[model samples]
Every structure is written in C-alpha cells, then in structure tokens.
Target: CAISQEELSHARDSLTSAQSALNNIQQQLSTSVALVDDTVVSSHPDVKAAAAQLRQAFLANARSTLVAPVTGYVAKRSVQLGQRIQPGTATMAVIPLDQLWIDANFKETQLGKMRIGQPVEISSDLYGSDVKYSGTIDSLGAGTGSAFALLPAQNATGNWIKIVQRVP
Candidate 1:
C-alpha cells in the first residue's frame, strides 16, 4: 500500500494545524491560571472596595426606614412623598397619649388660686363635656405671655393701656 503525495502533504498540514491549536489552548490556560494566582480571593483591594460599597448600600437602605422611639399615634406629619429630608429634622410629631401634659395659658387673674401639686379637673371640646380628665397642676408660669412674646408690644410709642396678660 502507498499513500498519495497530495494526501501526505495534507496530513502534514493537519498535524501542523493541530499543533498550532494546541499551543493556542495551552497559552490561554496559562494566562487564566496566572490571573488567578496574581490576585487574592476576597482580600484584593478592588474586591474589598466593592464589598464596602455593598455594605454601605445595605446600611443606607436600612436607614431609609424610620422607626419611632415610643409607641404613639403619629400626627402633624410634614414630610411629603419623594421629599428629601435632612438629618435631625423633625418630619412628624409622635404624640404618645400616655406621656402627655397640658400646655395651657390662662389669665393671670385665674391663676391666682392655681398652685403646683394641686388637684385639677380638665375637659376638652374634642370629646365634649362628657369626658373629664383629672390631673394635678404641674407648675405655674412665672412670667406673663407678653413678656415672652416673639414680637412684644413696643409700648413706648404713646398710649399707656393696661392689658390683662395671660400666664402659661
């Protein structure tokens, strides 16, 4: 049996092509292994940076939720949907009914008999006169309302009139 000259040349060319392909595959494998050896797993700077960014994103997402410190009914909320709120800003009032006190202002004349620790009866128009609240007079105001007003009356202009001041 004898091989043709054309077939012999073709076989030589095929062997050369196969060897070239094998060299290419080996080079690719070496490059991949070198890349893996050069860089550490999770301790690489880029990897650590990416992980830190992920942790920061998780923390920011967690902080997006607002939790009230006390169990209470929320009221007078000023924040709107999609509003950008600043840090330490009061977005709403958490009015805990259990921990509440009356902040009232009364005429000075009416406070004459009022004293701290005195038993007082309270009522609100919200519930009509049917609901009565019992409490003690916590404290009395030492100053009049005009004295603590934001824009106190500048009485130096002319007329001297006696105004009945209210006490808090």
Candidate 2:
C-alpha cells in the first residue's frame, strides 16, 4: 500500500522532532560533563589529595630507586637497578627480630575454662616438647569459626532441626 503525501510529511515531522529531542539531550549531557570536568579542575578534594599522595608516592618511588626504608644485607634482592616497583611490592622484608606472636588455634571446648586474666601455657610443634611461650588468654572470639565461614548455616527454614552451637 502506498502512503499519501500528507502521511509522509507527518512522518518526516515526527522524525525531525525526535532528532531534535535527541540533540537537546546530547547537548545537556555534554554540558554536564564539561561542568564536572571543570569542577574537578577547580575544586576537587581528590585532586588536592592526589598532590599530597604524589609526594608520598614519589618518596616511595625515590626510596625504591635510590634508597630503601630499612637497609639490611639485601639477602634476597628481587629487583635490579632500573625496575618499576609498585607500592606494597615486598622487595625485601626488614626482619628486625624484635617480637612476634604465635597464633595458637585452641579448640572451642578448651576455651570454656579459659578467661582473659587466666594464665595459660603455649607449646609449639616446631619446638617440640619444650614450652616456648606462655601468655594469658587475651579474649574469646565473639562468634564461632562457622560464623565467618562461606556458607553459614541457615536456620530460617521451618524443617530445620535444633542443634547446640558452640562459640569460642
């Protein structure tokens, strides 16, 4: 079926109106982007913070290039003279041999007799038989290990059976 000239004219007018609306929207978006860019240039806290961060970064960069934070014998030197090192990039650890804590994972049952002020004995498997370090129990965990587990038990179901739970 052939369209009348009048219908074709109306269709053209509709298309032109839609195009005009699109153009207006585009102009508004462009203006908004420009405004945001200008704001970033003028009064951005992040930009100001970036300047300070760059100083710290440069200090880190300079340390990586010329000097090091903690100079030792350089036991394990991973990087050569001119290598791009990133932040938190463990070039070498400064093992001061100052102090360290032994992470002892006591069972949930044993924790019942333990208290914050209660004295306790700690033995290391690496040391063997001999008691290495002794310390008081700092605190009990607020929740059990299963609390932070990936798939926590869902007790929301009506068909769920009752079970006694233990917490450290």
Candidate 3:
C-alpha cells in the first residue's frame, strides 16, 4: 500500500529514536562489563582490598583445618582446639639443639672495660666449673637496663643528682 510522505517521515523518525535508545543501552552494557572485568583483573585499590579479603578468608579456612609444615614429632603441644593464636605469639618452640647461646647480664660498671671482640669467659651454675664456653663480646647495650625500663625516671623538678655515665 502506498503511504503518504508525511506518514513515511514519521515512521523513519520513530525508527531513529528506537535506534538511539538501543545504542544507549548497548553503551551502558559495555560499561558494566568493563567494570566487572576491572574488578576481577585490574589492581585498583578496591579490587586489591577485595582480593586481600578473599585471601584472608582462604587463610582462615585453612587455619580452621590445621596442616603441619614440617614432618616432626610434637615435642609439646600447647594449642588446643578453639584456642586463639595471634600474630607474633609463640605457641611453642622447636629446640633442635643445633644452636644455643648464653645470655649474661653483666653490671654496667663491668661493661665499662668490655669492648667488641673482647674475649669472654662464661661460667654457668648449671654446669659448674666443668664446662666453660670461651666466647667474645658480640655486641654491647646502647644504654643501661634502667634507661629502657617501663617506668623511666622523670626529673621534672629542678632537683637533680649527678650519675656516673659509663662509656665502652
């Protein structure tokens, strides 16, 4: 059927508007897909945060089920089920006896004469006189034990006292 020129123009205008709407919807869909891909592959802050959370969840799941890293006998088990183990917390120590050292707390006055690489004669009460480990001074303290105390001395008032400082 032959249509009027005015009706044909209206039909063409309607088709053009519908095409514009379809193009807009397609653009939005493309943008949504790109965002989803970025969330999975891109290393943005939000993506990294989500990945870190997923990794932590995986670690927590693994911790819920314990798996030993080394094949060794349980020298002494301290952790029980449902017990919490925080970061840097020592549940137990594996003493292979392959390495050992003696911690000696010499007086501040005695350390005055001590120097790096100086020979040291260590005598333990447990071993008595039978065993003596001859070693050298590895390192010295920066300050006295009292300096790093929990409750450090405070001299807020004008009252002061002269203390002998040692240097090594």
On TM-score, the stronger of 1 and 2 is 1
- 152, model 2: CA deviation in Å? 3.6
lDDT of 1: 0.90
List the candidate numbers ranked by lDDT, top first: 1, 3, 2
Encode model 1's per-residue lDDT on 12-63: one tens digit a residue. Answer: 9999999999999999999999988777789888989999999999998898
Clashing pairs in 1: none
Model 2: per-residue Cα lDDT over 1-168, one tens digit each = 999999999999999999999999999999989878656463678788888898999997776554645434444667766678787776754443334434455567677677877876777788886756766766677776577678978777669675545664
Worst-scoring 10-residue span by lDDT in model 1: 35-44
Please state the error at residue 159 of candidate 1 in Å.
5.7
Model 3: per-residue Cα lDDT over 33-124, one tens digit each: 98876564556788789989999999988867745565444556778777888776656545444344455566766875888899878788
Question: Residue 53 of model 3: what lDDT?
Answer: 97
TM-score of each: 0.58, 0.38, 0.39
User: Which candidate number maximizes TM-score?
Assistant: 1
- Give residue 108's error in model 1 in angstroms: 2.1
Model 1 spans > 4 angstroms off: 1-11, 23-49, 58-97, 154-161
Note the residue pairs that clash in candidate 2: none
Clash counts for the predictions, in order: 0, 0, 0
